[model samples]
Target chain A: MNARGRIPGIRNQHQVLFYALSTCIWCKRTREFLEANNIAFDFVYVDLLSGTEREAVVEQVRRWNPSVSFPTLVIDGCRAIIGYRPEEIQEALGL
Target chain B: MSEIPREKVEALYQRLYEEAEASGYHLNPDKEFTLGLVESLLINEARYGYWACPCRLATGEKQKDLDIICPCDYRDADLLEWGACYCGLYVSEEVLRGERPLQSIPERRPPEGQRPQEQPARAPAVSVTELPLPVWRCRVCGYLCAREQPPAVCPICKAKRDRFERFL
Candidate 1:
């Protein structure tokens, strides 16, 4: 279950890592935005994880966002964008 | 995820809309967005045994997650400052008037370990004779009232009695 759910986009120009909670509307919107833009990404529903796996995932998210808020997008494993800022997301992906 | 019915979501939406209006608060006028948050509230309510804010992760313990509960402790401040609560379910006058663009706000809540403990509320320090009744403040909305006991439900935010703390 540690494997993330991957959405294949028309182009995988950059490795996009998405951390989200399935119950969060903002996360949903972020997902919709990425899909609409056809950006390939890997996402995990943090809430659905349990036990040590959840802790490991939380640490992963904490590295990018100490607040650990939802819809965290990590582009190329170096830059991370917090929240659903469409303009920032586009800029990060160089779209 | 529990399968919440459309009627369940609609009923709660109508109730919250009416209650918010009655208390001089405004629900986000984007009906679809508001209803999405409402539906998430139901999911959290069923999963956590309380209505945790959909945008924040809930630890599933009522005591630890109390402040992040729906209509969260930060709601009023967020509404006042950002024109919308972090989750955007509740909005401010500016948003209601279409003067402010509604969007996701920064998380005012600190990380789990960084959070400050709830304010100390063991006893009232005011002179009973001078004030007659103690002042109780809603930790969520900052509504204050002088009374023997806090109201069963907060008139302004509708947070339950336990959410009230003695202010004076």
Candidate 2:
């Protein structure tokens, strides 16, 4: 679940990594949206991780975007989308 | 963290209900969920000595987190614009009445760098009997207490220490 992988048929060939909190309603909605669209994505529940592991993951996210908000979507390892913006996610993923 | 007694939490909830009624504000309609959040606030107060938002990570630097205390500075605006606060513990009247659906609210607290920097200051200690204690008011429930400092948790509203403002 930690390693990035390819999602077949995604137009941009961008690997998607979802950082989310297990208890966050918005994160759950975002996951449902992706699933409903038949989009293949990998997600990590940040809250479920151990303290040290969570800190490392959060640091990684901070390096990309300082807000460190929930439901952050990393595209192709470089482009990061903060929050659950469905329109933005669609535009970024070309879905 | 020490476990907070259920009775304490219930007392706080009752106070919150009264305060909200007086202020024309509405708590979340989901009673069980609201109770859970209040319980979390109590736990955080016990653990951290302040009632930090249970949903957001606190850096443990009071100055840096002045905006994110439970009943955060953004709650009123959030309720006005989005029908609910960031944590949905507080909601607009329409949402309480089921006239409006609660929607996801974008984070309103400014990012770390954009937040106002804390100014440094110091106050000399005074004898408790010599000076009147500062009065702190809970923004959420309007509970007022006169003490040298705000309580770790609002006994009435369960709002965090930072949610208190000096009234006198």
Give me the candidate number with maximum TM-score: 1
Worst 10 residues of 1 chain A by lDDT: A1-10
Question: Chain A TM-score of model 2 versus the true structure?
Answer: 0.82
- Cα displacement (angstroms), candidate 2, residue A10, comes to 8.5
Q: Write the per-residue lDDT of candidate 1 for residues B10-128, one digit (tens) a residue.
A: 99999999999999899999999899999999988888888998998788888788888878888988998999999999999999999989998899997666542444545666556
Per-residue lDDT for B10-114 in model 2, tens only? 787776677777767788888876776677677767656666665565665677777677677678778889998877778999999999987656677777666
Single out the weakest 10-residue window by summed lDDT for candidate 2 chain B. B116-125
lDDT of each: 0.87, 0.70
What's the residue-level lDDT of A68 in candidate 1?
88
- What DockQ class does candidate 2 belong to? acceptable
Per-candidate DockQ values are 0.62, 0.25
Clashes of 1: 0
Candidate 2 reaches a DockQ of 0.25
**What are the clashing pairs of model 2?**
none
